[model samples]
Target: MIGPNLIPVGIAGLGSYSPKRILTNWDLEQIVETSDEWIFQRTGIRERRIAEDGEDSGKMGAVAALRALEDAKLSSDRIDLILCATTTPDKPFPTTACHIQNAIGAKNAGGFDINSACSGFVFAFNTAAQFIATGMAKRVLVVGTEKLSTILNYEDRNTCILFGDGAGAMVLSPLDEAGRGEYLGGSIQTEGGKDDVLEVPAGGSTLPTDKRVLEAGLNKMVMGGNRVYRFAVSTFVKLVRQAVEPYGFEQLGRIVPHQVNQRIIESALEKLDLPPETAFSNIHKFGNTSAASVPMAFDEAYREDCLIKGKLACSVAFGAGLSWGHFLVRW
Candidate 1:
């Protein structure tokens, strides 16, 4: 139950950025011998974006942040904090949040990064809402940005065909007086002992960057695809059911899930006995952008009128680290 004294937080604005480069399945045919029919049939992705030179996570994130600030009509200096969710940081030392802070001129903002992989955006958004609810911050910028192309193994058709590069951002602020939209509540969870199902094996303390790691392609992402698909299908249904239990499923306006795969989303919705249109998805256009998928889809849904004001909507994601999370907003 919500406390009367607590400040209500809501999404004030949203924006997204995708690189100009489009990698089509036909294009993949030239590089990896994968057919367009096969890829679309299996993953429901025909193409995805690839960042150009110099378009790292920080650069793309800043672009998205600027658009979000513009949409919010809020000055950069007004952001009290920035929480960036990413698996691919521009560099190991300087947090990507700091880079975004400088780029967007959010000089008054304190910033940090969260690396929950695809689920990072939901986790970051929930964390940002807490700051607003507690009176710790009036406004916060939450960003989920990634340049997965930097670490993708083009030769590995299994993983390469399913990922992309992009960024999405949202500005969270106190719900306005008499406004209908407000954050409800949600959950972030991890099924431990399953990290090995999806991960990049090297470039960290456990498996430091080295010539052997490079030769073995440990720096690139690896996944047990079948295992992940099964887990995602079941978990997506479970999270959505749990989130809507308090409000009832019929009250859900839309579901913005991690755009990992079209098949996964469709299958999950099927299990819930819902129609295909119940969920909003652009995986066919952007593929799997990990952390960026949820926010990007959210931005698209709002712009396209899929999300209705005063109705509850759920954002869910699952990815590397074997992590998954979901959050609800009445918007």
Candidate 2:
């Protein structure tokens, strides 16, 4: 697992935000043909957040980004790059990152969007780290945010019950001169042939949005549950191994996995023979926030003192396009 050399990068700060509106399983039962017990048994998500009308991904992302900058004790002007990892952009032409940059007053930063679905945060973080590692950017802000409720088909109990809205952000910069920060590289794999396994069936370039697409629900997310469950379990195990192999078992401090499903995390970790405590899960509170899951969970673990400066932390995720990725950082 020894990999190519990389310049060390550091996590400058972290912050996250979930909407105030909570949609519990009981509430879901009233709207959809599902039960709390059934949802709990399968997904382990007791509740999830939903944005109020007019609160889009960009707005939520802006708040999280500001908090992240505050945590790092830096101003918005210091940010030279803003990478937003999201699937539910406010619009296709103006990226959610653009709105966030302006909202947070990051006038000096160049902003863009990354749409790798659930794996977006991990992908964006690694991409932003390279900027610091190669001296392309001094300070970067990476945010994983989603407004999945906007694109969910409530009539479909399967997909509707599994998604939520939220955002998580992190600040990245060159390692401190004291050599306290480190960035260990990770791996990513994609199975394009399996792209149809999980995705929004329409609303993209090929399947441009139309009244028919909207009426048919093709514009919303549709997943092959059985296929995705199997893929996720195997992919999680593979990504975790790649994420930890470079540092060995002893140096592996913690794993912050995407909160897609509690059962998926449990099954994968059990197969890997790692104790449940080694991984973190917030699905019960946040549900499947797509790109927001990993970073949101990582922030919770960090606040509890689990992710310390000398300890290593690995975050991994899997999502649409059959994409999966791992990212390791030393806080």
Candidate 3:
């Protein structure tokens, strides 16, 4: 059932970045009533990097993007588009991708930012793939960067211990042949009815910032942990199967899931009947870095030679917007 017009898009290069500041579980104990053992057993997170003062999403993204371009052995002038996926953007106007374009001196490209929370990267990847598939762009930079530490409610142990800041980018280019790209098949799904389960209550058009909201700290992230946990585990398992079944499940070589939490990841593996070692994770070191998790893991796995050429690798993630999806890549 392959479409006659189907085209391929492959990753030419990859790069990632994390801020200098490292916040450890012991650091959390100093601020909250949590123990290192409790956090380790619960989330498998020992430490996470925090963006330094004045370091915004765009800056982190630009650094990662530059590395990706360099790795691809391409100059900024060759890039045709930039897609930055982030929830913690620098501002509401100008879009973070535009700022990245200017910072990286990619004057030849025009771009936009996408917000699907932790699922942002998969969403961006799918979007960028379409641009190449339809012959709209040649070289596209797809970046997933976030400075979640900026908006975290430090006083809330439930949320504060679960987030960090970082950025990761990939250089994707069009491939003339079918089934010969960095990715093969993927799908995205959203459940707006569950939006309230994880969201920032203020500072949006629906609930503009006010003195009362600001004083109440309503702008910070809020999460119904149990609800999101349930949804994340189920969605990840379901969509992963959806993406892999089409390619023949037995052909899969490895799984690279979003570094959200150890428990959720373990649950996903259990449900899928896949071994734990088949999945690459860095949540213990980076916590939940939102969109950056997958690419960061991708870079690390690639370096460790966990993702080999012509091997089937599947990436899955779930996040705010109650969105979730998976992508099957031929590495």
Candidate 4:
């Protein structure tokens, strides 16, 4: 809860980076037993970005961070904290946030990582806002980067076709009287006991990597698509209403949602009684980028003038861990 003594935080700038290589649905036809029509009808994705040989999560995050700093017209040294949200960190050690700090030359910033699957970006954004709200930070760089391609088993069409590689970033700072956007508040909910619904079953403390595990493709992403789809459809509506209803529908500019699936998003919007264009989505272009999805969509929507100045914009996301989050912004 925000206290009267706490300072308000606002988004200073936004940026996103998508890899150059485009993997079309037709390409998936060659890779797996799926056709373009089948995939698009189900997920509303026609193509997705594939990171190049040298593009890792850290590098992608750094690029997006630099772009965000440029957009904000602020230097990296001004950042007080760096928060990165990702399921696919460049490495388990040192944290992807550390790599980004070094790469971006954020010499004065302390950094860390947050892993909440696809809900990660919203989680990280809320955490960043707290540091600023408490006056511990004046500028916080929040990044959501994922090199999901690294952990995918391409042969498995179910999960492989649903994710891509990318990064998105935003600079959050204490709101000033003239600030263009304000971070209003947010809500988050997590349902445990559903970790098996979507997970990378191995390479963790519970299931350390082994020769046998590697042979079984245990490190690759596994998902119960139907279950996740149902959860997303319902939870998306709940989260949007929870964050947006208090402010009223007419006051909202746009809903930036985690680009998980086109069908899921559409279903939720229908249930919420919102217009088709009420929410902006790029899943058709980038598939589900996990934590990177929401921020990436934010960047695109802002650039396209979908999120207008002096208007309210809300971001919502959900993923593995059965976790979901939403944040309200007055832009």
Candidate 5:
């Protein structure tokens, strides 16, 4: 199941949605001890989108999925599977995928959710691709949606400045022999041992929410930025190297990576001897939308014409399972 029986898969359509609210660095400047310049220099992010009180990942993802369906010239009922990737869902029960499916009127679509923190979208995309490849499905909708603003501890400037809320969706269908492009090979890996370095202290079975947990400030996100940064850079470089292997960077049209940090992307690309221009990033505008980062970047790059049809693209991401993975595609 792991090797050699590959089948060609390609992106059929793409769309992304971002909330209307703008949270500028200057706005954050008033809330924390940080300045716009400091935040820019450190994360290469100037602003990010914030979901309104009633907005959730499901709502945003449904919008994105509808747009993708429109882009592909397909109807919602045509989709065979729907995969929702997110860290922040509207509720604990009724997976976000169900919400999107219901919202979009995708009665025929079987759906579920995936939580790989930031690396979720790519993981979901590849998993859906495999289903198509195996002849188990014909059309799949994969969405990376996040309401990170809800979980973030605004008091912690370190984590607050690094995330945002958004959703990105893409349609996947098998490619014919003469199709314009194909999804080549890629890898997904995680280092569970390193989970302690980055996590939310409570709200899960390990530390269910209680007044004490709330009073102790254990219900929000917590991150060891320095350690995560180090791991990010190393894991990023390794994934790229492994993904490119025999095919090589020269065959790639662009590298759309998880928008965790500009510095990490730049450093990892530099370490890999890859050109700066080859990396496509929208972090400056959206910060890190966790699982939404890679797909959001992909959608933006496609809109900007950076992701031209018939060109190869590599998507790499690292997130909280201490999860890190990469996928290759041709647009």
Candidate 6:
């Protein structure tokens, strides 16, 4: 078992990045059989960022990481480890984290990428926290980024309207206090049976890309919207209760959930008896950036002073792998 005197890990800084190119709902009308009203009513997304053709997952992650390092008043050389979580990587080999390391000039730090769908950031956070708590690393950079627009099928209204491109990052370091500064309390669960509900149909080793497969657009994300929605609502409520209740946060200050959809957020709030305002949502501005959504919302909250010192904040997310988890932090 871990010792009670173990070093406490706290978030030293936070940052996020969204491409300047905006893709509004009006852009969808020309491509799919949907209108702004229909998409807005169902998903609460009006616009989302689309990375430029030259920008890939690695570059976006690097941008966000640099901002985080700046916020911490630390340089890249000071970092001990870098963990980049993403579903869309520049390539399978070199590891996206390595690319970010190169971009940021963190020559001393070595890291890798994690592919846990939306639960990726939380997983990476937990992993980095362990390293800090155990004295393996002094400072670690955890980033979640994606260029989903590249893999999305613009013709499919249902899925296309639900995704966007962006990145978010955090600097985790050991805290002097015990049980202070971003103490995460929750369990991570995955139901492989429901994995098929949301997935990219092809293009990996199981189904390598080919001319015929390319023509059929097999590399794009395909989601069963209704099924995933049902699972998300249920999981969000359960994880929130489990994480905050034990800590006695009956009046939890803020909840930064994954910006998947407005409806899903409302459903989870209703089930948890939380007021609509208790949840911080930017789906309208950034769509579902998957793993990046929670941290992106966090950076916005901090900038707007929505998360005050001593306030209890909870971050929750659910996604493919049918995976879900929660992290509670005292700012």
Model 5 clashing-pair count: 0
Tens digits of per-residue lDDT for model 6, 172-264: 887652223466554567778775688887889988989988899989988886998888888888888887886675648899888878999
Steric clashes per prediction: 1, 1, 1, 1, 0, 1
Please give the TM-score that candidate 5 achieves against the real structure: 0.96
- Ten residues in sequence with the least summed lDDT for candidate 1: 177-186
| Local accuracy of candidate 5 as per-residue lDDT tens digits, 51-86 | 998899999999999888887778999999999999
lDDT tens per residue, model 1, 227-319: 999989998999999899788887988999999899999999999988999899999999999999988999899889899877788988887
TM-score of 2: 0.96
Best by TM-score: 4
TM-score against truth, every candidate: 0.97, 0.96, 0.96, 0.98, 0.96, 0.96
* lDDT score at residue 165, model 4, on the 0-100 scale: 95
The best candidate in terms of lDDT: 4
**Which stretches of model 2 miss by more than 4 angstroms?**
1-6, 177-181
| Candidate 3 per-residue lDDT over residues 56-108, each given as its tens digit | 99999999999888888889989999999999999998899999999999989
- Against the true structure, what is every candidate's RMSD? 1.3, 1.8, 1.7, 1.1, 1.8, 1.8
Clashing pairs in model 6? 310-331
- How high is the lDDT of residue 25 in model 4? 93
The residue ranges of model 5 lying beyond 4 angstroms of the native Cα positions read 1-6, 177-181
Superposition error at 298 for model 3 (Å): 1.0
